[model samples]
Target: MFKKIDFSFEIKAIGYAFYFSFLPFLFFVFQFLFGEKELSFILLKQMEFLIVPFSAWWIIFLYHDYFEEGGSDLLYSYPLKAEEHGLLRIGVFSALYEILIAICCMFLIVRFPDANFFVLFIQYAAESLLYTSIGFVIILLTKKVMVPILMIVAYVSTEFLTEGSITPVFHIMSFNTEPLSLDQIIFSVLLNGCISVILFVFGHLYLRKKTDLRLF
Candidate 1:
């Protein structure tokens, strides 16, 4: 199970996640150094927020496609079980993304000091894990890359319509000045944990039942 992911795949995900996250950092530095127009800076920040989620989304799919596409055949021929394989994939990808978000949040705190960066950062990390698992579940069920992309579009569109304006991607929920009470934080983490478990279970079952299906 531990051997399911190749070093090449891990490197690719890590590299892309770090590379894309630099958008916001670069935008802030450019504005501070060159005195770019306010509107241009705001636009760059918005783009950065939108692009961050795609890093995790793309990386999850890359790992899945890299392994499940051809690696599955090799695994079946070995002694590894499907459930173990699925769990290992989930563990690695999720860890990589959590670290990616941590690095992004460090930049965010340096850029925006008015907000409770930890709370918002935690929320963003939770949501990223949830949506990433959902993305994997979609691919496990359908094996089509377009499914995840379309789902992301729908998600962002819904956020835009309901939120009225998109400031920071973390601002999808209303920004709270008061610190999140312990109960609130615990409940939120529990809720996200449940959702992640559900997605993992669904993906595991889908793969187990359709182990022979050809996927792109």
Candidate 2:
């Protein structure tokens, strides 16, 4: 079925996602628990970074578990085609996160009427998608999750340390100091989203090639 995923995988993925999300959820919850009703720049930065890695770890785990730890033979035995399962993983998670990110955006908008809800939502989507794709591609290449996670940590740390001096239009905190016009925001979303899609497709291609290699 084009629409069905293994119920077991779904449950396990959700469980891992919860584990990955727990710390960030606590950070988010503490905002309200500590009388942080006013819009805080620190909160904005925290949300930005937290949202970036929100789904990334679980996604890496998904591929690593199925591909690396689960054994290559299991792939041939799975009900869904390899491509279908991978796409479903991305689709289901991205759709679920859209709602989650929307709720976060809504709460922030309520607290700060001046906040640009649209820009905030798009920014989070773009950044999360980009980072998740990075994790996705790297995991496929390295056949391990930790490598990509560490690589991302290093990459993001470098980006922050340099403060976008290397790539102004692409860094996560590019607009933290000076707000970007809506046009710039849209452009960044398009750029990052396009790159994410490319990496996703590239990962799929690698997966198919890998399977073919084992088959032949």
Where does candidate 2 stray beyond 4 Å? Answer: 13-18, 35-39, 166-169, 172-181
Clashing pairs in 2: none
lDDT of every model, 2 decimals? 0.56, 0.69
Give the top-scoring candidate (lDDT). 2
Please estimate how well model 2 matches the true structure, expressed as its whole-model Cα lDDT.
0.69
TM-score of each: 0.65, 0.84
lDDT at 9, model 2: 62
Error of 1 at 94 (Å): 2.4
Report the C-alpha lDDT of model 1 over 1-216, residue by residue, as the tens digit.
476567585556435543554565455455545654444334223433453445346445554534545554544564655675566766666676566566555544554554355764666666666666777777666656677768767766666566635444343332232334445565666577578678878887776665545332
- Once fitted onto the true fold, the runs of candidate 1 whose alpha carbons sit more than 4 angstroms away are 1-4, 9-52, 63-75, 114-117, 164-189, 212-216
Q: Per-prediction RMSD in angstroms?
A: 5.7, 2.8
